[model samples]
Target chain A: MPEITILTEQELRQCAAVDAGAVEIVSDAFSRLARGGVQMPPVMRLDVAEHNGEVDVKTAYVPGFDGFAIKVSPGFFDNPKLGLASVNGLMILHDSRTGVVRAVMLDNGYLTDVRTAAAGAVAARHLAPERVGTAAVLGAGVQARLQLKALTLVRPVERAVIWARDGEKARACAGELADELGIPVEAAADARTAVEQAQAVITTTPAGSPILHWDWLQPGTHVTCMGSDADSKNEVAPAVLANADGLVVDSRSQCAAMGELHHAIAQGALPADIQPAELGQVINGELPGRQAADEVTVADLTGTGVQDTAIAVRAERRATELGLGTRVQA
Target chain B: MPEITILTEQELRQCAAVDAGAVEIVSDAFSRLARGGVQMPPVMRLDVAEHNGEVDVKTAYVPGFDGFAIKVSPGFFDNPKLGLASVNGLMILHDSRTGVVRAVMLDNGYLTDVRTAAAGAVAARHLAPERVGTAAVLGAGVQARLQLKALTLVRPVERAVIWARDGEKARACAGELADELGIPVEAAADARTAVEQAQAVITTTPAGSPILHWDWLQPGTHVTCMGSDADSKNEVAPAVLANADGLVVDSRSQCAAMGELHHAIAQGALPADIQPAELGQVINGELPGRQAADEVTVADLTGTGVQDTAIAVRAERRATELGLGTRVQA
Candidate 1:
C-alpha cells in the first residue's frame, strides 16, 4: 500500500500564503515553462448549467520536479446564495517517476487563489516600475484584495485604490485591506480616478464587457488583468491591448481563446497575425517585457496548469517540513 | 463542512464486483449515454516516458444522478518487474448539485477492473449468442479471467478456452479459472484454434499486431475487443471489422482515435465516413445489435468516462448502505 498525506484547508493555510516564497516559486515555474519540455495539457472543463456550476481539471509535468499536480476546481455560482463559498477544490500531487499519488491537499481553493495572486506579482516583478508609489485594483472581491497584497511583495506599493460597481462594498474592502496590509487603501470615486494615480493596476472582476478604457493608462504603469478567464468575460477595453507598449500572456494559445487577448482579437483591435510574448518567455529573458521606463505594459493571466503544479509542490514540501498533514495508507 | 466517505480497496471490493448487478449498472449508463445530455469530456492523459508510465483522467456528469465521479488511473507497465502492480489509482465522487466532493474511493484500480469487466458483460449480454456453450479469451492476464467470469453472468458459458504467447501461463490460468468458475476449461494451441470452437471470443491482449484473423471467426461468434485502447495496440485484424455483419463501438469519436476502428480506417479496410452504431444504441433498441443468430457482431470497447461515473456511483451507494467507509470532514 502507498502512503498518502492528506492536508486540510487550515493546514494548507499555514504552509502556503501570498508571500515572497510563493512568488519566487511561480516565477520559477514560468521560467521552466519557457525553457521547454513541460507537458501541460489543455484544461478539461465540465459545466453543470442547471445548477450554475462548473468544474475544471488541470495538470502539468515539469521535468525537474519530483512530483506533478492535478488540481480539481469547482465553482458553483449559486453556492454563495446558500451561504457557502463559491469555489471549493483539492489538489492531488503524484510522484513524477512512478505516477503514484503522494499527497492530497484539500485546500478548498486556497492554493488556487494564492497561485493566481502570485502570478500577478510575477507580472509586476518583471514589468512594473522598481518603485511603485501607488497600486490600484478594480473590484472588491477576495481576489481584488489578494492581488494588491501580492503586488506589495514585488513592488514598493505605498498606497492603493479600490474601485468597484458596488461603492459600499468597495469602501468596506478598502478599509479591511488598509488594516490588513498596513498601507493606505482608499475607495476611488471612479475607475478613471483609480487608474490615473497608480503605477500598477490590477483588474479582478467577472465583467462581460470592458471596464478600463485605453485613455486611462499612463506610461510606466503595469496592468495585470486576472479576470476575463472565459470567452464572455472582458475587463480591459480591446483598444488598451492595441495601445500597450508590451503585451504578455500566461499562455498565448489560451489567452487567444479565453483571455483578454481573446476579446482584443475578436474586436480587431489587435492584428490577426500579431504575436504576443508569453510571461514565461519574458521571465526567461527570451522576450522583452518593459523595454523603456515610460512604456505601458499589460499581462493577461488565464491561469495555467503549470502554476497549479508549482504551487502544490511547494505546499506539499512545506507541509512535509512542518509535519502538518495526516498520513493515510492506501 | 461536507462529510466525505473514504472507502478503501477492501471496502470497495465488498460493495462492487463483477456480477449481474454491475452489468446492469454499466448497461444503464451506456443507455443513458446514448440518450444524450451526459456531460462527459474527452479523457485527459499525461505521459511519463522516462518511467514508461502513463496516467489518464476521466469524468462525467450524468443527469438525474445526485453524485458524479472523476477517476484518476495510472498505468506504470514496468512496476511488475519491481514486484508491484502496473496499474493503481482512485475515484472521487462529488455532489452534482453543489459541486462538493462526497466520497473518495481508494480502490487501487479494483473498481476500474470491475467496471471494465462489467462493460464486457454488457457487450456480451446484448451482442453475444443467447446461449454460449464455449467462450474463449486471447490473454492470460487478470482481465482475461474477469471477462470470462463476467460473461458467465449474462450468457450460459459452459466451457472456456484460454490462449496466450506463454503456454505455461495460459495453462495455469485455464486451470485456475475452471476451478473458480466451476466449468471445464482448456488451453488452446493457437489463436485460430481458440476461436474455431468457441461461440463467443474476446480479445484481451496488448498485442501490437493483429492476433485474431477474420477467417478464424465463425458466423455465430461474437467478438469483443478491449485491448486496443491506444492507437499503437491491435488485437483483431482490420479485415475482421470490414467483414463483420454488425459493428458497434462505445464512443464513435474515441473509437476513431484509438480503438480497432482506428486501425481499420488507417489500413483503408473500412470506409473513412462509416458511422458504426454505438453499443448504447443497440441496448436501447435504437439500432440493430445481432439481427440473426448467424451474424458476426463485434463491439470495440475503448472504455469511457460515463462508465467510471456509473460504477463509482454504484460503489458509493452500496458502501453507504453497508456502512463500509470512513467519514471525514472537509
Candidate 2:
C-alpha cells in the first residue's frame, strides 16, 4: 500500500510562512511561468447559489518539480454567522512521475494566504519605489494584515494605514497590526485618505464596486490589487488602469476575463484590444515592470495555480522534514 | 476547528458496493441531472506526457444534497512496470452550506470503479431489452468483471462471454467470473463471436482504435461503450453509431468532445450538428430509449461528475453510520 501524509493547518503554519523565503519561492514560480512549459488549465468554479457560496478548483504541473498540487477553495459568505471562517480549503500534492498521492495538506487556506501575500510582496519588490515608508491597505480582513506584513519584507514599509467601510473594524485591525508588526498603524478616515498618504497601496476587499479612484494615486505610487478575482468584484476604478503609466497582471488572459482589467475594458476606460504585460514576463526580464521612478505602476493580481503548486510543494517538503502530520496507508 | 472523516479504501469497500443499491443511486443522479438545477463543471485534465500520465478533476453540486464531492483521479500508464497501480486518487466531500471540509475518502479508485460500474448498469437497465439472458464484455480488466456483475443486478443475465486481445487473460477472467457470479462464462474466439452470443454487450478496453466493428454487432443488441472517455480513445467503429437505431449519451456536450460520438462526427459518419438524447433525458422520460425489442441501441457512457458526487455522498453516509473511519480536526 502507498502511504500518504495528512498535515493539518497547524502543521502547515509551522512549515511555510509569509516572509522573504516565501516571496522568493513565489517569484521563482512566476519567472518559470513566463519562460513557458507549465501546464495550467483554466480555473474551475462552482457556485452554490442557495448557500451563497462558491468553490474554485486549481492545479498546475510545472516541469522539473517532483510533484504537482491541486487546491480546492470554498468560500461561504454566510459562514461568519455560523461561527465559521468564510474561506477554507485543502491542497493535495501528487508525485509527478508516478501520479501517486504524496501528501494531503489540510491547511484550511493557510498556505493560500501565505502564497497570496507572497505574490503581493513580489509585486511590490518589482514595481514599488526604492523606499516605501507608508503602505496603505484597503481592508480590515485577514488578507489586509498579511499583505502589509509581506510588503514589509520586500519594501521599507515603516508605517501602515487600514481603511474599510466599517470604521470600527478598521480601527480594531489597525490596532492589532500595530502591535503585531511593531509599526505605527492607524485607521484612515476613508479610502481616499489611505491612498493619498501612502507610496504603496494594496487592495484586499471583496467589493463589487470600485473603492479606489484614479485621482487618489500619486506619482511613483505602486498599487497591488488582489481583491477582484471574480467577475463581479472590483477594487479600483476602471480609470485607474486607463491613467496608469505601467499596467501588469498575474495572468493576462485571466485578468481580461475577471480582473480589474475586465471592468476597464467593459466600461471603455481602456481599449478592448489592450494587452497588458504579465507579471511573469516582467519578473523574467522579458518585459519591463516600472520603467521610471516617477511612473504610477499598477499590478492586478487575480492569482494563479502555479503559486498554489509552489507553496504546496514547499509546505509538504518542510512538514516531511519536520516529521509532522499523520501517515496512513493510501 | 471543524472535524473531517478520513476513510481509506478498506473502509469505503465496507460502505458501498456495486449492487442494486449502487445502481439506483447512480440512476437517481442521472434523473436529477436531466431534471436540471445541477451545477457540474467540465472535467479538468492535466497531461504529464513525459511520464505517460494524466490527472482528471471533476466536481458537481446537486441541489437538495447536504454536501458536494470533488474527485481527483490520476492515471500513470507506466506504473505497472514499477509494481504500482496505474490509477489511484482521493475524493473530498464538503458541506454545501458552510463550505467546510466534511469528509475525505481515500478510496484510491475503488469508489470510482463501483460508481462507473453502477453507471454501466444504469445504461443497461434503461436501454437494454427487457429480458437479457446473456451479456458480453470486451476486456479482461477489473471494470470488465464489475460491468458483467453489475448487469446481473438489473437484468436476468445467466451466461456471459469475455473477449480481449490477450486470449490467456480472457480465459482467466472467464473462469473467475464463472466462479464469482455462479453463471456459465466462456472466453470467445474473437470480438464478433462474443457480441454475437449476447443481448447486452459492453466495451471496457482503453483502445485508441476501433476494437469492435460495426458488422460485429448483432440485431436486438444493446451496446454500452464505456472505454472512450478521452479524445484519442475509440472502442467501436464510427459506423456503429451511425447505424444504431437509438443513440444516447451521458452528456451530449461531453460525448461530442471525447466520447464515441466524437469519433463518429469526426469521420463524417454522424452529422456535425447531431444532438443525441442524453442518458439523463431517457431516465427522466424526457426522451425515448430502447424504443423497440429489436432496436439496435447504443448508449455512450462517458461518465459525469454527478456520478462521483452521488457515490461519494453514499459512501460517506454509510461510513459515518457504521463509524468506519478516523476523524481528525480539520
Candidate 3:
C-alpha cells in the first residue's frame, strides 16, 4: 500500500522557516515560469456571501518537478471580529508519475505566508536599489511584517517606516520589526511620510480605496505592492502605476482580473508608452527592470500557483529531512 | 480543536449499500440546484499527462444543509494495466459555518459510484415509464453493473442486455449481473441488438467516438447517457439527442461544456422547437418528462457538484449512525 503523509500545521511550522533558500526556490520557480514550460490553471473561486467567505483553489505543474500542489485558500472576512483568523488553508501534493497523493500540508496559510514573503524578497533582489537606505512599508498586518523581514535578506535596509489606517497597530508593528530585524523602525505620520524618504516602498494594505498616491514617490524608488489580490482591493492609486518607469505584475492574466493594473486600466490612468511586463520575465532577464538608476519601478504581486507548487515541493523535502509528520497507508 | 473522522475504503464498503434513500437525497439536491440556492463552482481540472491521468475537484453548498462536500477524483487511466484500479478519490466534508474539516471519507470512489448509480435511478424513476421489461446497459464496466442494480429499485427490470468493445468482457459482465441481481442477462452482438428490444437503455461507456446511434433506439425507451462528462468522451451520436422526444439535462451550463448536448450543438443536430429542461425542473414538476408513454426520453447527466455534496453528506451521516469511521484530531 502507498503511504500518504499528513503534515499538520504544527509540523509545518516546525520545518518551514522563511529563509534565503525559500527565496531561491521561488526565484527558480519564477525563472521556470518565464521559461514557459509550466501549466497552471486559472483559480476556481467559491464565494459564500452569507458567511462573508471566499475559497480559492489553485494548482500548477512544473514539467521537471517530482510533484505538484493544489492549494485551497479560504478567506473568511468576518472571522477576525469573531476572534478567529480570516485566512486558513492546506495544500495537497501529488506524485507526478502515478498521480497519487504524496503529502497533505496542513499549514493553515503558513506556507503561503512564506512563499509570498519569499516572492517579495525576489522582487527586491531584482528591482530594489543596491545601496543602503530605509524601506517603507504601508501596512501593519502579517504581510507587512513578513515583507520587511524578507527584504532585509537581500538589500542593506537599515530601518523601516510603517503606515496603516490604525496608527496603534502601525506603532506596534514598527516595534516588532525593530526588535526582530535589529533595525530602527518607526511609524509614519501618514502614507506620504512613509513614501517620501524610502528607497523601496512596499504597500501591503487590503484597502478598498487607494491608500497611496503617485505624487509622493521618490526617484529610483522601487514599490512592491502585495496586498491588492482581489477586485475590491486597492493600495496605490492608478496614477502610481502610470507614473512608474516600469510596471511588472506576477501574472498578467490575474492582474487583468483583480490586480491594481485592472483598476488603473478601468480608470484610464495607465500610460500608453509603458507596456507592463511580467515579473518572471524580469527575473529571467528576458525583460529589463530598473533600466536607469533614477527610474521609478513598481511590481504588483497577486500570488501564483507556480509559487505554491514550488513551496509545497520544498516543504515535503524538508519534512522528510526533519522526520516530521505522520505517514498513513491512505 | 476539531476532530476529523476518517472513513476508509473497507469501512465505506461495509456501509455504502445502494438504497432508495440515496436517490431521494440526490433527487432533492437536483431540486435544490434547480431552485437556485446552491453555491457550486465550475469544475477545477488538473492534467497529469506523464501519468495519462487527470484529477477533478468538485464541490457544492446547499442552502439549508449544515455541511457541504468537496470531492477530489483522480483518474489514472494506465493504473488498471499496472495492477491497480484506474479511478480513486476521497470526499472532504466541512462545516459550512466554520469552514472546518469535519470528516474525511477515504471512499476510494465508492461514494461517487453509489451516488452516481443513485442519480441514474433517480433519473429513471422520473423519466422512465412506470414499468420496464428489460434495460440495456451499453458498457461492461463497474458503472454498467451498478446502474442495472440501481435501476431495479425504481423499475421492474427482469432482464438486461449489455454491449461493450470486447464481447468477452460484455459476457462476463452479464454473467456477474445475473448471479448478483437474480435476473436473466445476455451479451449483445452489437449496439443495435442491445437497444432494439429494451424498454430502458443506459449508455455508460467512456467512448471517444459515437458508439450508439439514434436509429437503433426503440419507441417508449428512456435513455440515460452518463459517460460524456469530458469533452473528449462521446458515447451516443449527436443525432440521438436530436431524435429524442424530450431532452432533460442535469445542468444546462454543464451540458453546453462537455455533455452530449455540446456535441449535438456542434453538429447542428439539436431541434429548433425544443428547449432542454433541467432534470431538477422535471423532478420538481417545474417541467414535464416523458410526455407520452410511447415517447423517447433522454437524460444527459454530466454529474453535478450538488450530487457529490449530497452523497457525501449522506455518507457521513450514515457512517456516524453506524459508528463506522475512526475519528482522529487532524
Candidate 4:
C-alpha cells in the first residue's frame, strides 16, 4: 500500500504559500465540468429536522479516476448554543487506479473555508477593479474575516468597513482584523453606510432576508456575495442583481437553485436569460471579467466541488513535504 | 465539543451486530431514494498519474440535507506489491443544522464494503426466487465472499459454486466461506458450468471484459452484477442484459452512465428507456420485482450515495455507543 499523507489544518494553513498554484487546478476542473469532461451529479440533501431545513450534498465523478470525495456538510442552527463551532468535516483522498485508501484529511472545515476564501480571491483578481482601494464587508463571522483577508491578497484594499446586525461584534471583528492585516478598518453603523464609501463589497452573512440594497451600492462598486447557499437564504437584494452591469458565479446550475441569483430569479427581479459567466471561464481567460472598472459586477460565490478537490490535492502534497499528521498505509 | 466517534475496520468487525442494523438503515435509505425522499449527487474522482489512474481525491455531497462524504480510496493493484489492503478510506459526518463537522469515521472502507454487499443482498432478496437453493459466485474476492454471506442471510441457499481464473484461490475462498456458513461449496471449472447449475448468479470481478454468457444461465437464474462501476468496466455480456425478463439497478442515472447497464446500452443491446426498476422501488413495493418463478432477472449493482450516507450514519451511532477512536473538538 502506498503511504497516504494526512493533512491537518495547521499544515494546510502553512500550505497557503503555494495556494496560488491551486487556482488553475480548480479552474481546470470547472472548465472540464463545463466542457463535459467532468460529471457532476445533481446536488442532493436530506432534511434531518425542520429547524435545520435541508443539508445539500453534491458529487462529481471524473472518468478514468478512482478517487471520490463525499462532502457531508450539515446545517445545524442549534450548534452554537451547545458550545460548538459550526462547519466541521474532513476530506478523504482515494487512489483511483487501485481503488485503495490514500489519506484522511482532518480539515475540520478549514479546507472549505480556505478554498472558498481563495475562490473569492480568484473572483476579485479577475472581476474587481484594477485599482481596488476600499472594501465593505457584510457579516462579522469567520467567513467574513476570511473574505476580507482573501480580497486584500488579490486587490490593493487599504481600508475596509464591516457591518453586522450586532454593532459591537462587527466593531470588535473589524478592530481585530485591522490589527492583523495592518490596514484601516471601521465598523459601519448600517448596511448603507458600509457600501456608500466602498469600491467593493462582500456579503458573507447567512441572512435569508435581503440585506444589501441596490440603491446603497455605487456604480463602480463590485459585490461578492458568498452567502445564500440554499433556496431560503438570501443576502443581496434582488434589485442589486438586476441592475448589475455583469454577473459571475461559481456554478450557474447551483446558483439557479440556491445563491443570490436564485432569490433574484424567484422575485422576478432578474431575467432568466441573464447568463452569468462561470468563474472558471474567467480564470482560464476564455471569458472577459469586469469589462469596465466603473461597471457594477457581482460575483456570486455559492462555492463548488472542484475547489474542494483542488485544495485536497494541494494540501496532500504540501503535508507530504512538511511531514505533518499521520501517514496511514492502505 | 461533543465526542467524535471513529470506527476502524477492527472495531467495526468486533461490532458485527451493527452490520445487520446497518442493512436495515441502508435498505430504508434506498427505499426513500427510490421514492424521491432522498437525493444523491454524482460521484467525482481526481486521477493522479503517480497513483496509476486512481483518484487521489474524491468528493460526494448529497444536497437535500447538507451532508457529504469525501473519500480517498486508492487502487487494489498496488496493495499486494506494497503489502497492504487495496481498499481503505474514511467517512466524515457533518451536522446539517449548523454546517459543523460532526464526526470523523475511519471506516477504512469496511463499512462501505458491508453496505455495498448488503445492497446486493437486498436486491437478491426482492429479485431472486424464494427458494434460491443454489447460487454461483463468479469471483473469489472479498466482495464475492461478502456477497455470498449477505445473500445467505437473506435467502436460503443449499449450495454455492465459486469460479475464478485462479482455481486454487477460488477453492480456498469457497472452502473458508463454506466452513463459516456451514453450507456446501464447490469450485466450478468454468463460468458456464457455474451458472448452469445455480438458480442465482453473482459476478464480482473487476475485469473490464464481459465474463458471463447469456446462454449458460437457467431460465429462473437471477443475476447480480456487482462490478463494472466505471465506464471502461463491464462484467456481464450485453446479450445477458438483453435477454433478461426484468432489469433493476441502484440508480437509473448512474446505471445509464457507468454501471453494467451503461455497457449494454453503449453496445446497442439496450434502449434508452429500458426503465429498469430501482431496487428501492421493489423494496418499497412501488414496483413489481420478480414477476414469475422462471423469469430471468438482473440487478445492476452500480452503488449509490445513499448507501454511503446510511452506513456512515449507522457506523457513527454504533462507534459512539462503543466509545471507539479519537475525538477532536473543532
Find the number of clashing residue pairs for candidate 4. 72
TM-score of 3: 0.96
Q: DockQ for model 4? A: 0.29
Kindly list the per-residue Cα lDDT of model 3 for residues A1-330, writing each as its tens digit.
Answer: 457777877888776667888898888888888888677888988777788887788888777788888887777788778776777767888776666778877777889999999999998888888864879999999999999999998988988999998999999999999999999999998989989999899999888899878889888899999998888898889989988888898888888778888789888896433358888898988898778788888989999998998899999999999999877666
State the lDDT of candidate 3 residue by residue for B83-197, as single tens digits: 7777776777777766667777777788888888888998898889877888899999989998999899899897899999899999999999999999899999998998998
User: Cα deviation in Å at residue A156, candidate 2?
Assistant: 1.2
Scanning candidate 2 chain A in windows of ten residues, the lowest lDDT window is A19-28
Interface RMSD of 2: 0.7
Tens digits of lDDT, candidate 1, A46-115: 9888899999999988888888899998899999888877888888998887778788788889899999
> What's the lDDT for candidate 3?
0.85
Would you give me the overall lDDT of model 4? 0.75
Q: List ranges where model 3 is wrong by over 4 Å.
A: A271-275, B80-83, B271-274, B326-330
- Screening candidate 1 with a backbone cut-off below 3 angstroms (N, C-alpha, C), the clashing residue pairs are none
> Tens digit of lDDT per residue, candidate 1, span B1-330?
667777878889999999888898889889998998889888899887878888899998888778888898888888888777788888889888888988888888898888889999998888999988889999999899999999999888889999999999999999999999999999999989999988999999999999999998888899999988888998989999999999999989889989999999999999998999998899999998888999999999988888888899999989989989877776
What TM-score does chain A reach in every model? 0.98, 0.98, 0.97, 0.91
RMSD of 3: 2.0
C-alpha lDDT of all candidate models, in order: 0.90, 0.91, 0.85, 0.75
| Candidate 1 deviant stretches above 4 angstroms | none
How many clashes show up per model? 0, 0, 0, 72
Docking class of 2: high
